[model samples]
Target: MIDGAAKDVAQILGHIPALRRYARLLAGDAAAADDLVQDTLERACAKWSMWRPGTDLRAWLMTLMHNIFLNRVRDWRHDDGHAALEDAPEPAHEPMAHAPEMLDLHRALDRLTPALRSALLLVTVEEYTYAEAAEILQVPIGTIMSRLHRARETVRVLMEGPTDAQRTHPLHLVKR
Candidate 1:
């Protein structure tokens, strides 16, 4: 049998394509995706010895990649003097097939607190369970549920802004 280190290396190799696929989806830029994948690999290799065998390696690697991205963003913000975000030309906006509600939904998501947005995306977009998102975000399950509820409410309010204000008469709150 190969040594444990060798086995770990093989496992990482097997996971590279999946990692790249996920990174690509996350970054939306090919070069940035590759960088994210590389960052994840470097961190994973460094921590290989500590990784317990037969556990969920993919989730661990994904968590590591997420941290790598968050750290890079934190560093960029911290170094505003020399590493400011450049004024790149915006990509031309093409018409999407989304409904009016979708536009409001996207805007509301962008406007959400990062904690709430992240929780919502992890659970809804990425299809992670509330428990899995909680584990990944290092928050309690209750926090995930609260964030999900808040995110949905925010989106609904945004989508209904005009309609809500245009009502001719207010509905009674009484149960009669």
Candidate 2:
């Protein structure tokens, strides 16, 4: 039993980096992301027995993190004294080593709705399959596809300006 528990701890520890990455992208604030990861680890440790031995632990952990994040968002909405999560200023940090385009992509990601951003990050950044991402997000596969589509399009527009079709389309133009 001790050996089994030790193995479980090791496995859970192995997934922490992935959790931190996902949390950072999802929260868009390093401090908030670290808090989210810590919360997730605490919950996982408390519920370790409930996890099946052969299951995909990373997906399970991500599901817990996602649920926790959603709950926080819901709570934040009800709390009148707190500033909006999105309105919180970006945390100070060293500049990223990536190019200007990567910075733009990050900014575009920050602008996405939480649901859309979650879907995009799970699929693109974390490299989860559509089915896996759907399971993690507790949504249907079709819903994941739709969210990914919208998220990608929004990011593209934000990064590259509108496409030619968008520029030429009467419906996309401002009416004076």
Candidate 3:
């Protein structure tokens, strides 16, 4: 039988691609995303004892990555005379595709705020349930729902480019 540590490594390795995708969404740059994933994996290995085998391993790993990202954001913000965006390398341009829908979705995703983007990607791209996303993000379920709703609306508006109906018939909430 494989030891617990080996099993844990295998499980973590299986989820690295997903973690990298989530990190890319959160970081907005490919290199930064890779760094985030590396940090997350390192932390996971270092703190392997804390992880319980039977529970949701993916969720636990995501939580670690999210926390690490938040800390990085905090530190980046606090640094004097440090401009993170300025330091970031420019992304290489790729050839245009025939499919506009995919391009539009990517552009809309780029426009979203980090929090909204993370929430949307976790639920939509990663196919995580609302509860799982909430747990990974360390937020309440209601907050996750609210973020998802707003994120969806925002992405829709972005992809659709402010239709006339949006101006004439704004969305309204009706209390039940």
> Highest lDDT, which number?
2
Cα-lDDT of candidate 1: 0.74
lDDT of 1 by residue, 69-105 (tens): 6787577668856532366554345364357665566
Rank candidates by TM-score, best first. 2, 3, 1
Model 2 worst lDDT window (10 residues): 90-99
User: Each prediction's TM-score against the native?
Assistant: 0.66, 0.88, 0.82
Candidate 3 residue pairs that clash: none
Pairs in steric clash, model 2 = none
lDDT of each: 0.74, 0.93, 0.87
Tens-place lDDT per residue, model 2, 86-167, is: 9977667647735788788888998998899999999999999999999999999999999999999999899999978888
Return whichever of 2 and 3 wins on TM-score.
2
- The C-alpha local distance difference test score for the whole of candidate 2 amounts to 0.93
Clashing pairs in 1: none
- Cα lDDT tens digits, model 3, 1-176, are 46966876788999999999899878866788999999999999899889887899999999999899889978878989785777966665645457888778877888887678879989998999999999999899999999999999998988877778878878956899
Model 2 misplacement above 4 A: 84-90, 170-176
